[model samples]
Target: MSRPEVLCIGALLWDVIGRAPRRMAPGADVPGRIRHVPGGVALNVAVALARRGLAAALLSAVGRDPEGDALLAEARRLGVLTGWIVRDTGLPTDCYMAVEDSAGLIAAIADAHSLEQAGAAILAPLDDLPAWTGPVVLDGNLTEDLLAAIAADPRLAAADLRVVPASPGKAERLEPLIAARRGCFYLNRLEAEILAHRACPDAASAAEAVVARGAARVLVTDGANPAADAIAGGPTLAVPPPRVTIARVTGAGDCFLAAHLAAGLAGQPREAALRAAVEAAAAHVAGRDLP
Candidate 1:
């Protein structure tokens, strides 16, 4: 087997998304389309990377139930490696459900308790390796304690670690990675504001604030506005995404991150990588596949 170019660690589950055609208000029943797809921060990014021709592997926990079995098969079909994933017998597969409309996502729920419960077991692979030098994409759905431990682990000291907050609610959980200054963070404007404990009106400010908080690098995206990328002590590079009609908003960020990483791995310059990321995300939001 070929060595993986990237390792994605976190939740692997089903995404149940209900999207309405028009703007939706609270307690209003409306016609919509509901679909079930394989998703989760880690899985989404892994699939995106695979579509970009990267050898990505997943190190996460999934149940041994039918859902988990089918998800693993789907990942394999998509060219994402699954040998390192843990099949937990104690828990059922995890899931995420969200409601979206013309404006944007109205609400969502993530039932990733199994991943949180699996804890360090999912990371046991790292214990056998002396050091991992490849890039690792970490999902913030992990418990704060586990995130902190991984940030401080010696086995990953030389790794290029990229972190993503699974959602705005889990944004604060990435503080440990920020404090360690060992990971590149991918976040939306609101998530950055939550982590930085201040209001960030734009993606540029949010990127700067996150870098100032001790991140090695940061990428901040504001829906339809502009996205910004910055390295520690470097000038922010802001790029606007194509103003496309919203199709679905669930996996846009993951697609962006995967495209950016693929661009970087292919030796694209900073600005080029940022632009590629923005464009890929735009395509994804327009109901196009990443490839």
Candidate 2:
């Protein structure tokens, strides 16, 4: 098989999202909608890239169970290449559960135990392939050891690595990447603060702090506020997102990262790429299905 333009590595599983149209408080049993969709940090990014006409492949683990079979089918339907995914018979498919209210994501739990348990087996395909110097989108959902190994692996040293923290809780798990200065980091304000170990009043401060901590490049986003994209020894670019009434919040950040990477791969200027990413995120939150 031919190599894909981009490879997404990390969690690939179902997203079971419970959304309520009204404000939610603890212990409030309000009626809501629950839907199971093909999701996960890597999968979401791959789908977003595929939607933009990019050839994207997934490098992750899935079970041999029925749910895994269904998810693989959905991934193919969405144009994501699953040939590199490891189907482990000993483990069950992973999943992510989230609760969202009108305000935003109230809480989330990522049950990515299988991917963590699969360890290095999920990455076996990379060993057989030629040295990939293209873009690789990596998520923090993988175990810390695996992430460290990937960071130091010579096979990926020449690739354009783009890493996301996955969430605030997993932010510190990206320390290996940050210490190695291996990739362009993508994260929201809270995740940035966690990684930087300081409170960032705004995106600009967060981006600066992360870069000071040896991040080669960083993008920090604050909802509705301006976002900052910073490169070492370069001017930090800050751009405000288009304000829109949020219809959903599960995959907005993934959409933003994918759009930015796609624009960069297309040779768009730095500022232009950041603008396109914010625009894509705004459209996603506004429930606009982008092509």
The best candidate in terms of lDDT = 2
Cα deviation at 275, candidate 2, in Å, is 0.5
Candidate 1 residue runs with Cα over 4 Å from true position: 128-130
In model 1, which range of ten residues has the least summed lDDT?
122-131
Winning candidate number (TM-score) = 2
lDDT of 2 by residue, 154-245 (tens): 88889899999899899999999998988999999999998888998999899989999999899998999998999899999999999898
Clashing pairs in 2: none
Per model, how many backbone clashes are there? 0, 0
Candidates' lDDT values, in order?
0.91, 0.92
lDDT of 1 at 277: 98
| Model 1: per-residue Cα lDDT over 1-291, one tens digit each | 357889899989999999999999998799999999999999999999998888998989999899999999998998999988888638999999999999889999999988998998998877755589999999988999999999987888899998999999999999888888888899999999998889988999998988888888999999999999988867889999999999899999999999999999999999999999999999989997522
